[model samples]
Target: MVAGRLSRYFGRRFLGASLTVFVGVFGLVLLVDYIELMRRSAGEANASALLAAGISVTRVPQIMERIMPFAVLVGAMLCYLNLSRRLELVVARSAGMSAWQFVAPAVIAALLVGVIATAVYNPIAATLQEQSKRLEDRAFNNAAQSGLQATGTGFWVRQRSVDGQSIINAASSTDQGVRLGGVTVFMYDLAGRFVERIEAKAAVLEEGYWRLVEARRYPVDAPPEKLADHQLKTNLTLAQVRETFATPETVSFWDLPFFIEMADHAGLAAAGYRLQYQKLISRPALLAAMVLVAAAFSLRFFRFGGVQKMVLSGIVAGFLLYVLSKVTEDLSKAELMHPAAAAWLPVFIGVLTGLVPLLYLEDG
Candidate 1:
């Protein structure tokens, strides 16, 4: 009964600390993002404070998802350190409780938190992220742009049809690239000769063609003609269009499997999505490993001294883990490593890094 109570107490402390840190970080990110948005929209007449705030509120969740692991690490460390200072850990240790025994609750809690973050929080963030994009577009009048937007470099697609080939560009796109804004299409013949150019305000992918709206056709040898609507032949499908704009971060964890399968069926590379799915799968283990890391650094008896040094080491170790994850992520994105390997290598290394020290401290 006492042991169970201790476990609950430790779990509650860890969760409380983590929640406090997470909220602090969220507010900081929201404030910084709002200020940046405000600065960017300073000269725009259509931009409003409410729009910027809404965008920041929606976007901060995705950013927070990335920060969750760090919060767990810091919170766990603080929880352990505080317990050590209060002699709670000392009493627990004196009661024949092993460090692992006391730490198990926190580890379990962290794993549950990771699962919740990946399953529930991710979908909400993805939906909000999409909304944030729409609000940003509305605030900046991005749909009315005459050329490619400065951010993201927009999207480009190439199509070859029986008639000829065309290179399509858009300043902005939505609905997974099914709809495009500030569109331009350049046509060329089989012999690579310049054919014509079509500039449109918008384009939508249809059953068998691209429906361009408010378009101007400039023929190679004749005068430009304005057309209210024009249909351009194409052979691209919805899957291909989705591949062009569905970045991995913007995709929900629950939907990643379907996307991966679609990309596979379409013979398109889905490395980013594959990596993201694997990352979410490994999140629980990664967060559990972080608990071990925190325990390793913060479990020293309060009277043993060197507490500051241990705290610094913990911070440095956490930063190194973040850097390692990023390095492996880049390698995965570049296709230099398999997505599963890239997603799990850092996690494996983290577990080892934390477990080795704890094993030494506890058993040796």
Candidate 2:
């Protein structure tokens, strides 16, 4: 199936169509997101349109990557529908060729495209996304010094040790919990009774403890005491803090293994990275599945008047698949299901849903 003049021709057609659709969709996404960003920042000071545009563009690759399966679906639909319209498929069918035979090239092409996207394009997207976040912090977050942000609350982290339990909060923090501003600490004894409240203008993560500056401590039964400096013991490390808010997409496929290991060692949740790793490895199969879905909707000619409806149905199905994946991811992140099961189950279901229909229609 991978070799022959006809196979080459079909492969070229499929690859060309998919690439064109990917480019077009990426551009459309960039324009829409850029405009949205600008609209949101309309009243904000120092919001550069060019910077916003650049951030939007950088985000396009990642968004495009997510929708690549949909592109494959549309591309295959377009390619096959055109062939049917031009009577190419009719000729092939008359020559004793079957749908499965011709669809092989497109399936192969989709597999290759998925592999390249996961391996190469993903890393670049992640880097640019990180850059976009930095730009956002500078533009609106005052370089991330403002803690708890617009929501009127801050992030919370916890520590439990022989000393008792403590909850930490900051208005904003660095990637690592190394530095924080507008910090507060609440400590409780082994029995969960309140022991003290500590407030600080700033906090820095030092070896074995947190170093607080401009600190005031209020004991449970005593008045507030001002202090120049204070130390609180901590088991959390810099890596754990850095990984806390790090979403799966920020880590590349190649780096995910190491990231997961480090995150687990640092006592951070590693399920997100594990789930992303599973998804990355399953991309090729998912794209091929999309090709099958396209074929299921594409074999009819436009002259029959129902082709448009089928195409719409196919596109809607692709969107549903994306939505399903997101839902499963949330469930996995919440620990309701095993990470491997959550990531792979959706892909498997999507592939089977497409493949089974193609098998019955093509050969049955």
Best by lDDT: 1
User: Against the unseen true structure, what C-alpha lDDT does each candidate score?
Assistant: 0.87, 0.78
- TM match of model 1 to true structure: 0.92
- Models 1 onward score TM values of 0.92, 0.78
Output the lDDT of residue 66, model 1: 91
Residue lDDT tens for model 2, 223-308: 99999999988887766665664567777889889889988877777888998998898888889888887888787766777988
lDDT of 1: 0.87
| Residues 1-364 of candidate 1: C-alpha lDDT, one tens digit per residue | 7888899999999999999999999999999999999999999888999989998998899999899999999999999999999999989988778988778999999999989988999999988887777777778876644222425666778889998899998887665677788889999999888899999988989998999999999999999999999999999888777676677887899889989998888777789899999999999989998888888889998899999999899888888999999999999989999989988888888888888888898898
The residue pairs that clash in candidate 2, if any, are 147-171, 147-172, 148-171
RMSD of each: 2.6, 4.5
